[model samples]
Structure formats: C-alpha cells, structure tokens
Target: MEPRKLLSSLFYFSLLSLLSANQQVVDSAHHHHHHRHRHLFDFRPSKLFVFGDSYADTGNIGRSLAGSWKQPYGITFPGKPAGRFSDGRVLTDYLVEIGTALLLIAAKFVGIKSPIPYKFRRVGGKHLRNGMNFAYGGTGVFQSTSPLPNMTTQIGFFQQLIKEGVYNSLELQQSSVALLVLSGNDYSAYISKNGSSQGFPSFITQVVNQLVLNLKMIQELGLKKIAVTTLQPLGCLPFSTAASSFQQCNGTQNALVNLHNLLLQQAVAKLNNETTNDHSTFVILDLNTAFMTVFTNKGDHLGSTRFENPLKPCCVGISNGDVCGSVDESGTKKYTVCENPEAAFFWDTVHPTQAGWRSVYSALQANLQQL
Candidate 1:
C-alpha cells in the first residue's frame, strides 16, 4: 500500500475507535482533598538542568531526522511540533515551569515585557545564566536508535559552554536544582540489537554504573540539588504489554525494574554519604509508586480512569505485526487514539498522556516537599 493511503486508513481507524470508546477524563483531586503547602522549590530555582531521553527531551532533537519534530507529535502544544517527542508536554516542560516563572518575574523587573523564557533562547551568553534543556529524544547513556547526542554528550555540551565562559562561578553558585529523567531506552536498544534476555541483569548493572558516573559528573559541574526519577512500571508500558492484549503487565519485567530501583536506592544513599552537604542531595522521584497509585485507584479518580480494560492501549496497530506508528501503502493512518487523550493514561506505546503526568506529579508532592 502507498504510504499516504496507509496513513489515511490509520487516521480513519483512529476516528472510529475514538467514537466507540467515548472515554472521559478522570479528575481524582476532588475526592482526596490532597492539597499541600508550598516548599522551597515551590517558589523557583536559578536554573534547571535536564538529562535523558524523550521523556524529558524538550527541543534538542534535529527537525529533519526526528519524529519528535514531525506532524501529529505536538498537535496539542504551540499548535505545532516544538521539539517535544509527545503530543503536548513532557517532563522538562513541567519541571521548568517553576524556574521559567521566576525568569518571567526577573524580566518584569528589568522593564522588559514578555521576554522569552530561558528555554527558548540559545544555550550561550546570559541565557545559560538562567537555564537550558539538554535532553534529546532517542538518546540514552549509551548509544540508541537516533544519531543525537547521548546523556554524557549532552553534559559535554554543558561543559563546553562553561569552558567558553558562558557561565561564571557566581552564576553556577546560584544554580539550585537539576532534574534527571531516565527510563529504559538503554535496555530497549540492547533488546533491539539482539542482546540476550538472560544477560539483562549484567546489562542493567552497566547501565546503572554509567548513570552513577553521569550523576557525579553533574555534581562536579557545580549544580547543588539533583532529583532523579526512578524507572516507571516498564512492564505496564503500552508497547511491552500489548502482546497480553493490554490486560496484564508482565510480572517478570516489573521484577527487573524493581531490581534496578533497589540498586538505585543504594547508589543514592552511597552518594549522599560521600558528599559534604547531604540534605537529600540525590532525591529519587518514585515513579514506580506513583504509577501504581493511579492504576490501583483508577475509579477513585474523577470520572473513570478505569478503562473497561486498563492494560490495553487505545491507539495501536490494526494487527499484531505492526505498531502504533506503522502505515501501509495507502495514505491511511494505522494507529488509533482513545476518544479523549486526557482520559487515557498511556499516550503512545511508551510515553504517558499529559493527564497521566499530572497524576504522577501529584503523587510525587510528598517527596518534592523535601526539595
């Protein structure tokens, strides 16, 4: 089939699924009354340092080569692709809200109206004086599918900027927070490259080792507080569980994720013990717990976060052989979406919906209080 016709078919198929599902958004806030008072980070940070893959990538991906910069990806924000690998926002956008708000206030004081946020400016000059996003989709600690720079390379870019006097000692001293978002892209790459499943334990060890080194490198860069996300429920990702009809997450896969988190907990502890100022310097964002909270209390959320079948992804290939992004010779779309993206927890095969992230953020408030 022609690619155009294939896309057309997929589009129509998605439309039909949306009509039939008629899912509605689930707002869980009212029942819980879980609002909490503000903490230090609730105000603002001088800078926001980001690392990792598509989950946190803002605009580092090149326009011509990345699907993140293509149509249908950013349909929800800026009315066009703004370099995010999702329909709307990702981790960096949510985290940057705090600092960007501060930048806006500073602009107001300078008698400048509506100055561009630091994220929108180049990572040179005084712009780096505020903050800059360093994430690129399809990137990992090690090489992955895309040709973009990995996490280490991204940090290298930062180091180069510092060497060029883009940031001075005083500005680096003011830098308060750094956000690290790491998922299973490294593992995915290993699997895709025919790395054996039996070797996963060893591979995970290597990945964590690289991660620890990366964290140390960031601290050496003179940033103070660092918050790193634990791996989410990987087995529950739409792509992994699709084979089970999306009804059940793979227990074995989840067990591996548990091991990774356990190891990470120890690493964080060790890092704190070694550091001079140990006020929760390495904070772990427990995405595992947050994801489970939403999944278990689906109905508790306003409306029905309860999918008649939660494991199944709303948008997917017509057949098992294809995927959400697949298309045939015709100009028909192969993927389908739920009636409302807000109602669905998972967005595509791997990422979550904007609503899903909101839920995760709410769950993380307790840990965030210490920040």
Candidate 2:
C-alpha cells in the first residue's frame, strides 16, 4: 500500500476499535435497570470517571475564586475559561475519544442521550447512563485541602449512587473505567501546614497507602478497570520551578516524587496479582515519564504544537500580591496574558495548556487501552 493509504487504514482500524467499545458500553447500560448482564470488553472506554485535583478538574471548581475561571485560561479553544484550570481542555478532555459513528450507533440501538449534549449532541440520555464523573478541584486523598469531598468522601458519593440503584453491578462491570488522579495536593497541604522535609518520607508513604486503599475501594465498588496515575514530577511544575526562573526542575522534589510513584507501582502490582478474575485489573498510567518526554522534547514538541515557549504560562500575575486569577483592590485585573495562549504549555503557574494535556494524552494512549 502507498504510505498515505497505509496511514489511513491504520487510523480507520483504530476508529473501529473505539466505536465497538463504546457500543458495548451503550448496550450494557441499557439492561442495568432491567436485568443483570455481563460481557467481556477489550476496548478503550468511551466514558471517563475523573478523580483527583486540578490536573483533571473539568469545571468542578467554582469560577469566582479559581484561577481556571479567569481570563486567558480557555483562550485556545473556547476563547474563555469554561471551568477548566488551563487555557484549554485538561487531561480529562484529551484522555477521552468520542467518535461520531459510535455515538450515532449508540443512539440508534440504546436510545440513550449523551450527558454532555452540546459536545455529543446526537446521542440521547441513555448513552450518559454509562458513567458520570464526581471529581472536585483542590481536593486530596485526605480531608485537608479543598472544602469539597476528599477521596474517601468522593467514594462515598459513588456508594450512595450504587445504593440508589443509579449504577448496577453489571453496568459497572462492563462499561466503567475509573481515572484516579492524586497529583500531590496532600503533600502541598502538609508543607503549608509546616510539615518538615524529615517527615516527608513518612508522609509520602501515608499518601500512597491511602491511594492504594482508594483504588481498592473503587474496584470493590465494581469498576472493571482502574487507571491510577503515577504522580507527575511535582518539582517540575511551574509553581515549584519558578524559584529558578522556570529554567530547571528541582531535583530534590523530583526524587521525593519518584519514591511516591515507586510505592504506587508496587501497590498496583499487588492489586493486579490479588484479583480473582486474573485480568489486568489495575494499571498505572505513567504521567511522570510523559511529562519528562514533553519537557525534554520541548523544541520539537513545542514547534509541532505551535507553542513558542511551552514552559512559561500564558496567564500570570505581575507581582507577589497577584496571581493568575487575582484582581487589584481597586477592582482592576492584576494578571497579564500572552498574545496567544495555545503557543504556551503552562496555563497559570502549575497547570498545563490544553495542547500540553493533548501531548500527555498521546503518550498514555497505550496505557488507556487497558480501560
């Protein structure tokens, strides 16, 4: 075959795989309220149940106070903040792939509608019955960061839905994939509360322990596959690297982050081994490596994405008294925005642009297939 034809064929095959998977999800969701059913699914999940903090937050945070809600955040896609913490889509949006043929077929066979009507307009309400997200921004595995429910409490909400019969076990078994993201809000809170570096190791262990427990709980609640994230290079976040003028990542902080990721991998391994069904029940999405790849390939990656300076954020405060979302006492805007948000990777100080998330999503495409 010609090179162009070969590439087109590969793309079509991938599209077919996604459509078949989404169809199964629609079929399973249909029978949940009527009768229990089971079907083996080996396709990428169409529905994404996002958890964790800002990295995966999709408008769960309030607009008035969150930096994601301010100007220049969504300048790339929506032309304004549409509840994402970044200038465009976050990890959740890019991690998801919705093919039109699948949605149309689902609408025909299942008589279901898409929950996000504007985005997936043709699909009816029945399609949305596959999954619903419950993540909130600024939250941690523990109860210290955001006023919203922590990881435990978030699980509690899922439990409540189960009790109300919103999700039957069969539907959970067939169509569900949980995206659990714990990107270190707990550690940030610990440091802000005066926790010392000497205690960091122990705290890291505690966080991992809690995270493992959370993943187990999600599994116990009947989710088929749980995709937990290895924490990103925390020291590399623009917020932490700013002290060095965003030119270098803090090696010490990255070392600590590696320890946390090591523990998480171990926990995932144990979970996979312990599963009675002998399936690849637990998978760790390697966000750390993906972030590093993007950083190291900055020149090549940025040029491809049309980003001039990927590390620097598009919207930022001019001084210490301001932040991306802050306003002056006189009610004037205190932040500055780059001429083109899509040309930058970092959105504010810590978050990535939609383009950045797309890059990370591409890196994790293989891992996401398990779900």
Best-matching candidate per TM-score: 2
Evaluate model 1: give its TM-score: 0.77
Error of 2 at 273 (Å): 1.1
Local distance difference test, each candidate: 0.56, 0.59
Q: What is the TM-score of each candidate against the true structure?
A: 0.77, 0.78
> Which run of 10 residues does model 1 get worst, by summed lDDT?
17-26
Any runs in candidate 2 off by more than 4 Å, and if so which? 1-46, 98-127, 299-303, 306-308, 366-371
In model 1, how large is the Cα lDDT of residue 138? 64
Scored by lDDT, the top model is 2
**Model 2, range 197-257, lDDT digits (tens) per residue?**
8998898789889988999888888776676667777677666667888788777777777
Q: Per-prediction count of colliding residue pairs?
A: 28, 10
Predicted candidate 1 versus true structure: per-residue lDDT over 271-343, tens digit per residue: 7667765322555556676666677665224443544454455456677655545567885767665676666
- Deviation of model 2 at 179, angstroms: 0.7
After TM-score superposition, the amount by which residue 286's alpha carbon in candidate 2 deviates from its true location, in angstroms, is: 1.0
